[model samples]
Target chain A: MWETVLSALMDPVNALFLVGGVAGGIVVGALPGLTATMALALMLPFTFSMSPEPALIMLGGIYIGAIYGGSISAILINTPGTPSSIATTFDGYPMTRQGKPEQALVTAAFSSGIGGVLGGLTLLFLSPALADLALQFGPPEFFWVAIFGLTIIATLSAGSLLKGMIGGCLGLMLSTVGIAPIGGESRFTFGFSPLQGGLDLVVMLIGLFCIPEVLAMVDRKRVAKQGLALKREKGVAGGVIKKLVRQPLLLLRSSIVGIITGIIPGAGGNIASLLSYDLAVRFDKKHKDYGKGRMEGVVASEASNNAEVGGSLVPLLSLGIPGAAPAAVLMGALLIQGITPGPDLYTRYPDLVYTFIIAFIIANFVMFVMAFYGARYVARMIDLPADVLLPMIVMLTVIGSFAIRNSYLDVCMMLGFGIAGYFLKKVGFEPGPIVLGIILGPIAETGLAQSMLLGQAEGGVWQIFFTRPITLVLIVLSLISLLSAVYIQTSRAGWKAGRRDAETCDAD
Target chain B: MRRRLNREIGVSLFFLGIAVIAFIQVEGLNRMSAVFPRTLAVILLVLSGILLVQSLVRPPEKKKGETPLASSRILPFLLILVLYAVLIAGLGFLIATILFAGVGTWYLCDRNKIRAIIGSILLGILFYALFRFVFLVPFPGI
Candidate 1:
């Protein structure tokens, strides 16, 4: 293992890919409206030719870099480069306003690197044990896990529970448009040959995530004319390191929060960082200074979000289930390479797993170095005009969709989904749950069919669900996730209503 | 609020329609193949019904007067995307991309005809180089 790691590090080609992936990732991450998942989706077709190890290494680099890179724009323009960095904008932008942008940038970089490394270490050590646990999962348990993932994600993503579930159902329906998983029958092709193949997950992902973003760019073109450029003090980040040293526990706790959140199938970086920020504020003695340019807020948000990169990969590496959306895309990329991720991944290919882990750790260091030196140049990606940027993104998405199977049918599918996604997004339905549905639909179907067959052989169909301890645990977790999502969403809505009432009373 | 409720109700109806269609499709399939999708369709139908009822009970507050796709400018942009997709395979990727980017930039970004044309061509070449040359994607035309 050490020899392979050494060879990977020594291999000039591997080094180039690592650096190139991080650089590309940072550019994508620093650009507003571009996400880590979209970056991976765009890059997936290209990775098709490469071997699995280098392919994963490059993807891993992008994942880590993109997550950390989001902080750059969050600190500079108050707009998070990615959704995960949304919390960073709270304190980061304020620091920039105070002419302490360097401080915020440094803290974010340091924390992201630290958090990412810690998370990567967690993946390295913990994935094997998790894979061992996953081996106990039978077909019924697998079905339950998929259901738990789909329901929780769908229920949690949208502002309204109904809309989220609708999105999930819509995705499941889309996945069912091709052939039946169990029985050899065409389902919903409507007499089109392309429909027989079904909607490609990559095509759907690009269309759902990238196309609407392009349309949004056009829609907001007039409003998005403003450019953000900030001045930086090069050596100022040194002081942030000293300050961060004093609060080791906060960083550790935030990374742990990120890791745990990442392990949960649907919980992602945005949730991880926000939860970490809330914990930081709740536990801090200087809570009042939290939203007001405090360094701790920057640290907690950046650390947790960066850490989420590693955390999210844990499930993808162990079980076939993706821990987050980006990881889902990564899983798709793996599947494209004919590398199905499951418990067998760790056992069947320990070298690939170990090498990828090492590459992930190395990518963090590369991101740290690049972010430290290249912040000024990479941050300029914000100034690229929407007209140019949007069209360029459109070009890539169109071509990328076609490249999936060299099929124009996929391109049309992408455009159709993109338009639908744009409208769906406006109506309060999130695309996240929909993506989850598409990814998990086949898994659930196969498991359900196989479990039913097993059940018939044993006793009864209904007994399979209740007899398994794992299934029961999954059901309980699903219930908790659904209930908590409801509680949080309703409370937020109520609070908004209360504020509106207060304002109305004051006006009266 | 009424507008939002209308949208939600419409969306719910759409889902319900899809559920009905899916249920019908599942009817002819074997039990192994039919069970999962049928179950999903029923779940979707129930969920859609719940959504419709909720929207009727409590409509959300509206902040904007217009819907997202209501802008007069949006239809042309969308039409251009569809036209581009329809034309790309016949026109070749490079030509299609250049045309799409050029026209899209002219309409969506800058009206300067020369700048839009030149900039679009440059972007087209750049993308071609990256995907075709660097990434080796063989995007149907160099």
Candidate 2:
């Protein structure tokens, strides 16, 4: 492990990939409406020729850098660059209005850096044990795990559960487009010859995530003429380090919250930051300062969101399950590299795993250095016209989709999915669950088929799910996940109704 | 302003059609090939039906005043994308990319013609160099 770490550090090529990924990620995250998932999707084809270690190292840099980069626009323009930075805008924008924008920026950067480092440490420590436990899982357990992932889509669609489930079903249906996994028979090719190989995951990813952003940009071009102006100040970062040191507990607690949330499949950085901010507000003596230029609020939000980077990777590395949308893209990257991430990942490629983990830690530090010194210049990226940016992204998306298999069918399929994604988003359905469903669909299907084959030999199909202890645990987790999503939504509605009733009584 | 319930009903109906088509297609397949797709199709069908019913029964939520980004508005851009995909096959990678970028930049930003053309050409060259030289991805010439 030490040798691999040293090799990664000494190698110029590894450093290059890390630097490039971090720079690109920061730009993507700083751009409004661009996401880490889209960036990964656009770049996925580029990693096709790369060795697994370098490919993952580059992705890790992008993941960590993008999470931190979101706070830049959140502080300066009151627009969260990524969904995760939504909480950052609460206090971050207020500080900008107070003429202390630089301070808020520094606070967010430093907090994110600390949080990222802590999350990386948790991943390094916890993943091995998790992988050990996952080794005990059979086909039935795997099926249950996939079901648990599908259930989390309910949580993804908090506002519209029915729509979200439909999106999941859409994804599952699409996943069945090419050929049956077990039977080696075409199911839904519609007589199209090119589709026998299946809808390329990279094509769907770019189409669904990137193309919609471009279309949205064209639509909003008429409204986004005015740009945010940023003024840079020196010496603001020095004080933030001192403040971060003073509030070690807040940083630790927020990091813990982020990691835990990230470990749960489908709960991305946005949820982590929101939960962390709530906890911070509850414990803060300066509660009134929240949503009003409070440094702690900025710290709490940034820390947790960045921390989610490490936490999300834990599941991807251990259980072959994606912890978030970006992680799902990473899992695809791994599959393309012919490296299945599970218990064998630790045994077969320990050195490579160590190298990737070490690179992630190094990337966080690199992000810290770049964000601290180059934020003023980086903030200018926000000013680029949507017209120019959209066209450029379109060209990349077109090229990226075509490059997957050098097929026009893939490109056309991407456009079709892109159009579909745009309509889906218009009606309040998120693209995340759809993407999640596509990624997990095959895993669930294959697991179920394989489990069935094994169960027939063991007397009965029902016995497989009931007899296995691991399967039982997974089933319970799945139920808990699904029930809690519905429970939370109903209770929130009831609470709002009660509040409205009390207000009416008070008025009377 | 469009009502949320109306939009929901429309979406649900669209998905319902998709589900019914999927279900019909999988009907003659072997059990092994049909089980997964058929199960998902049924789930989608049931869910969309529930969504349609709920949308019909619920009171319409207050409509927001902002002009939502409609897919209809972006239909022209989608056509442009289709044209680019077809053209890329005829013109090859670099030439098609340059043409698309230059023309697309001009189309997207109508006022700054010269800047758009030059900047887009540079962008095209940059992408070509990055993909061909750095990543070594294959792109056929015309």
Candidate 3:
């Protein structure tokens, strides 16, 4: 592993690609509406022809860079470039407004690098052990794991539980459109040949997230504004280092939150960022400064979100289940390279895996350097005119949509989803749940059915789930998560009611 | 009051109708068909029922204001996409891309005619050169 890592570092071409990928990823990520997933999807054709090591390295660079790039917009403008950056805006914009934009940028870079390095190290050491344990899992255990992922419905639901469940069910129904998993039977093709393959997840994501956003932007006549001008400081490096030393615990706690959330298959960087930000607020001695521009908030959000990249890959490498949407796309890229993920991945391609881990560490380092030097220029993107930016994005989206498989059907799908997304948003349905559902739905279904079939051959459904200790443990955990979500919602409602009653009494 | 109730009822009826249609489709499938779709359809039916009931119980949130200009602006964009799709098969990637980029820039950006034309032509050539010379993507032909 050490030799592989050494060789990867020594290889000039690999290093060059890593730098290029990080740079490109940062540019792509800094652009609003150009998601990391879209960047990977657009780059898929290019990566198809490259060697597996360089390809994986490039993709890894993009993943890390894009995750960090989102903070640029979050800090400069109020809009988060990616969903994961939503929490960053809480403190990032406030910092910008306080004329500490450079300080915020430096803090973001430092925390992002620290979190990323920690996550990469976790992947390096823990993956082998996790892979070994994963070797014991069969269809039954996998089914339970998928069920556990579905249990995230409890956490994701913002409104009525029933509505969330209904939305999830709708997502499941959409997934059933292509073909039957068990047999080769075409179930819901509706006689259209394109429907045979069902809706592509990338198309679904682009439609659900991007289309609605573009429509909203057009509606509001939204224009990008020049960010708060700050005095050019020479000591950004010194400032970042000083803050790192001062907020060691905050960085550590946020990184841990990011890692744990990333390890969970359904909870991606978005959730990790939010969870870390919430914790930072709770832990801070001066909580009043939280939404009003605290450096701790910036550290917590950026560090945790970047850490999720490492966390998400753990499941992808060990279990063949992706930890997030972009990870799912990465998994697809891996499959295209003829590299199947699971226990065999460790045994068969130890060197490549090692190379990937080393490259991830290198990618974070590259991002740190880029962010340090390029912060001035990247910050300027916040002021780009929407009229110019939107058209360019639309052009790219069209080209990307068409480029996949060179199919016009995909173009049509993109446009259709764009319109559908616009309406869904207007109706108050969040696309986050929908995107999660689309990605996870097929995996959950396939696992459940296969496990049930195997169980019936053995004895019964209950025996199948209960017999395996690991499955039992996962099942129990899922129930606990569901219960906890319900408890939180109930307590929140109670608190709100109490506050309302007190206000009423005071008024009277 | 009547208008609001009418809209809710219409939405509910539409979903219920789709559920019925889905159920009928499922019934037509052979017994050998997997249990998953049938199960999914049944779930959808139940969901549609719930959505229907909810619509009746609670008035839909009244959305404020007119639709965004982008929704209307999308038609021209869609036409450009359609043109690219149709022409790409015949003209090949390079020509189709050039045409798409050129026309799309002019139509969507709202730039002056000369600027639009120049911008489109430059974008086309740039994409062509990058994909062909740099990335070796093999755009079809002239």
Candidate 4:
């Protein structure tokens, strides 16, 4: 593969796509209201002229670059450029307000690069093994997987587990509005034909994530504002670089989370980032500082999301199942080229596949080099006035949502979701669980219904779902997650009470 | 009852209402299609019940907190956004965007009328160029 690949790699057009794809991806990703999915969709037309290898490589580059690019807006403006970057805004925006935007961006770049490389390496070396692992998953297993993801709500909501659960239920219910995965029946349409397609994830994402923040910014008073000026530090973000380099465990842990999440079809970086962020909070002594300008928060999210880029490819290459939204677009690109991707693809086009994988790894390097230096200039978005930034963001979001399916209904849905999300956030509901629930609802429902049918043939539903080896393991993991969340919440309450008693004793 | 009310109780009741609505909607669907949504609706009811019980047993102690955003200032802007979305259907993308951007900026921009005017017009053109020419997004009136 490498022998024939050297000449293909040397091709000028491939080189341009590799570099330009990443750069263009980053720019699109950095803008508010834009996402990597939109970037890839727009780039689809350009791929018709190119050969299969270059087309796949260009889409791969864009996929990598755009996912990473989302962090820039997430950090500086409190808007995630993509759904995966939702966790990035948790700490990234706070760091920006605290005058450490430069450090946050640098941390994101390094962690994302490491995660991307690790994911790429996994694709290069472990795809065959991982793809085979993916085959073990059926509807029942996927149901457990979605349930396992939902358990993250326990730890995901540091405020109130009850509210998180309720929010998750709301998202799950929203997901059921469209056609049933197996029954071929529509439940919630109430005679409206447009809704038979259900709610678009991108529409909900824009509404629930971006809309609330813009409204809050409009309502917020200047007295509540922190350090408004962007900080310019010395070389390589000065001390922040050393601090990040020291936390190799955090990088590796977060990347592994991304990689694993990516391997599972339907589970994307959005879940990975949230899961790793939960893990970081669960393990750290200063877990309380997580949503409040923690560098570890940005690193955890960016690393995991980027690593997921690599992880998402595993399923696509192996089974033809797309692991994430962008990966779904890449699958379309492959099909358009008349190249069907699956197990047969490995034996059929070894050189083309191998070269593209190698090129994907190199694209991550280019992303780091470009994003690291380019971040400072990008961070200058802070210098733009709220008046200018505010309306512009809304405009971009309108265009972004509209571009998805060229429909006004999506734009309306976005506004509706944003308004609902704003009120929901005020009442202790975090978007992570709700979004997770939405993402998992389809998978969970499809799995449950299909497994029930399988169970009828195999003897019983319990035997089909609970008796399987993989199903049993997932059940245990879900139980552990639930128990851990309860323990953490109780312990935190006790700690606060104990400190209050100590203070009272001191006063006496 | 009003005095005992809190965000927890409010949210709980709201979700409980949703669950009830879901139960009503599941009537026409068959066993398979009804099962999942029905299950989710039950879960929502159970969680909301727990929350309601928890709040009733012991309401949270009120603490001084940061000022919440005033809806008076926020609602108008939110309405404007809805208006923007509505106008896109009638007036098309170009006209709707320019009006929304200019008016939204003017409303938020510390009263810099000239800047708002310039920014909105330029933004409209910029968005038009990017989406229409470069991306080839075929939104009506683009």
* lDDT per residue (tens digit) for residues A1-508 in model 3: 7777788778998988899889888877876666777667566556656788888999999999899988888888877777678788888988888888888888888899999998898888888899988788887777676667656653444444555554555566677777767655676677898888888765665566566665565554444556434456988669667868887889889999999888876567877888788788788789867777888888999999999899989978877767776787777678668887776688888888889988998799999999887867776665655545554454455555554455667766876777766655544445555665665667666766777778788878547867889988988978876676566457545644654674576579
- Superposition error at A491 for model 1 (Å): 6.6
Better of 1 and 4 by TM-score: 1
| Candidate 3 error regions (>4 Å) | A153-167, A193-223, A227-231, A385-408, A414-419, A428-438, A459-462, A483-508, B1-21, B28-32, B60-70, B79-83, B87-91, B138-142
Candidate 4 on A9-106: residue-level lDDT in tens? 88888988899989878876775545676577556645655688788888899999989988988887787877789889888988988977888889
Each model's DockQ?
A: 0.64, 0.59, 0.32, 0.51
Chain A TM-scores of all predicted models: 0.93, 0.93, 0.86, 0.64
Q: What lDDT is obtained when candidate 1 is compared to the true structure?
A: 0.82
Cα error of candidate 1 at position A485, Å: 3.0
Tens digit of per-residue lDDT, candidate 2, span A116-185: 9999998899998889999888888888888998997865664677777888888888888888998778
User: Which residue runs of candidate 2 sit more than 4 Å off their true CA positions?
Assistant: A222-235, A487-508, B1-5, B59-73
Residue range B1-142, candidate 3, lDDT tens digits: 4455555566456556755666676665544345656676676677667767877788665544644323666666656656665776688766676676667656645655676677666766776676556655533323
| Winner on DockQ (1 vs 3) | 1
| 1 or 2, greater by TM-score | 1
Pull out the clashing pairs in model 4.
none
Extract clashing residue pairs from model 2.
Answer: none
Query: For candidate 2, lDDT tens digit of each residue in B56-81?
Result: 88835754444444645566676777
Q: Write the per-residue lDDT of candidate 1 for residues A107-169, one digit (tens) a residue.
A: 998999899999999999999898998899999888988887876775337477777877887
> Local distance difference test, per candidate?
0.82, 0.82, 0.72, 0.78
